[model samples]
Target: MDRAEVTELVLSAKRMKGLTWKDIHEKVSVSTSPIVVTAALLGQMRLEPNEAAKAAELFGLPEEAQILLTEIPYRGSLTEIPPTDPLIYRFYELVMVYGTTWKELIQEEFGDGIMSAIDFDMTMERQPDQKGDRVKLQMSGKFLSYKRY
Candidate 1:
């Protein structure tokens, strides 16, 4: 399709009933910006086969969207989602704001090998704080040791 046609579809998808971009992002499990989503709609970038299927399930995309998964995308991601995606930035911000206690704690428990995010488990909890509120993230994964034993 042409540029205007593509953009109109994107905006329509963005507008579709009771749904919000934030909600779509959560369901889709990807760090997305307007630009990323738009490009994905316009076929400038691909969603990966699995991600395309998820997008279809989440956003209820059309059959045309299937081809988009194979398309090579333009550069996506504006800011990193943690420092990066503002939604997940709380933990990193906590590190900077609260201090390196988290770092030292990890080092003490884990020894040296870093935990693999790829093979990791993640949980987010909301707990009451003395001052107000907090977003707590708990992550656990097998330690991948550098020194072979």
Candidate 2:
């Protein structure tokens, strides 16, 4: 089965079993964050063979679905260029407005290197406020400098 089919099966099983991503992640014992585990379930990341088997056992997935989980997926499933969803669009707008500022600050502080998403960690939390609760997004990525040819 393709990644999409596997994703559907996973979602169906999750709904039927009333399982959360955190539940599956913990049960599967995958050495990754819940968000990463969710990404794998959504067919955005590849899982190791053992991890796939664990996930299959936890989600009642078939052997073919486990195989699909271990295969590399075509990441970035967004069909639109600038996301149409309001929440996601807000991020796009933030980048449009502060992209230059972020670039300048990062370059000044970290040299001509860029942050590596491959070696990144992110967390989303709620911050208490007088007016209303605010979102706190913490992201850390390794800084990689350009290699001189």
Candidate 3:
């Protein structure tokens, strides 16, 4: 099966078993963060051999599914340019509004460089508040300086 088919199987199995991303991650012992595990499930990352086997077992997936999981996936599943989903759209909007500001600040602080998503860590948490809960997204990526040619 292709990565897309495997992804659908993973989703179906997750729903059938009522398994959370954290649950699957813990069961598979694949990643420290559920986000990474989720990324694998969504076909954004390749799973190691052991991870693929464990995930296949946990989800009762076919043997081919395990093989498929080990293959590198075509990342970025969004079909449209600006995401149609409201939650994702907000993030797109955030970048549109603050991307330049972020670029400027980072450039000023670190010189000519860009943050590395390849070496990044991200976490999401809910903060308690009297009026309403607040979502906190924390991300840290290594800074890569441009090499002079």
lDDT tens readout by residue for model 2, 35-101: 7788889999888888899989987888999999989899989889799999989999999999899
Clashing pairs in 1: 44-73, 45-73, 80-84, 80-85, 81-84, 81-85, 82-85
TM-score against native, each model: 0.46, 0.88, 0.94
Top candidate when judged by TM-score against the true structure = 3
- Deviation from native of the Cα of residue 120 in model 2, angstroms: 1.1
Clashes by residue pair, model 3: none
Judging by lDDT, tell me the better candidate of 2 and 3: 3
lDDT of every predicted structure (CA atoms): 0.59, 0.88, 0.90
Candidate 3, 40-131: lDDT as tens digits: 88899888889889999988999999998888888888998799999999999999999999999999999999999989999989899999
Supply the global lDDT for candidate 3. 0.90
**What's the TM for model 3?**
0.94
Q: CA shift at 18, candidate 3, in angstroms?
A: 1.1
Residue 49 in model 2: lDDT: 88
What are the per-residue Cα lDDT tens digits for candidate 1 across 1-149?
44334445555766875666556556654655443454565555556677667766655556665555546654433456457666557656876876567556766887766667446555556799999998776777777766866
Better model by lDDT: candidate 1 vs candidate 2: 2
Descending-TM-score candidate ranking? 3, 2, 1
Q: Which consecutive 10 residues in model 2 have the weakest lDDT in total?
A: 27-36
User: Once all C-alphas are superposed, what RMSD does model 3 give against the true structure?
Assistant: 1.2
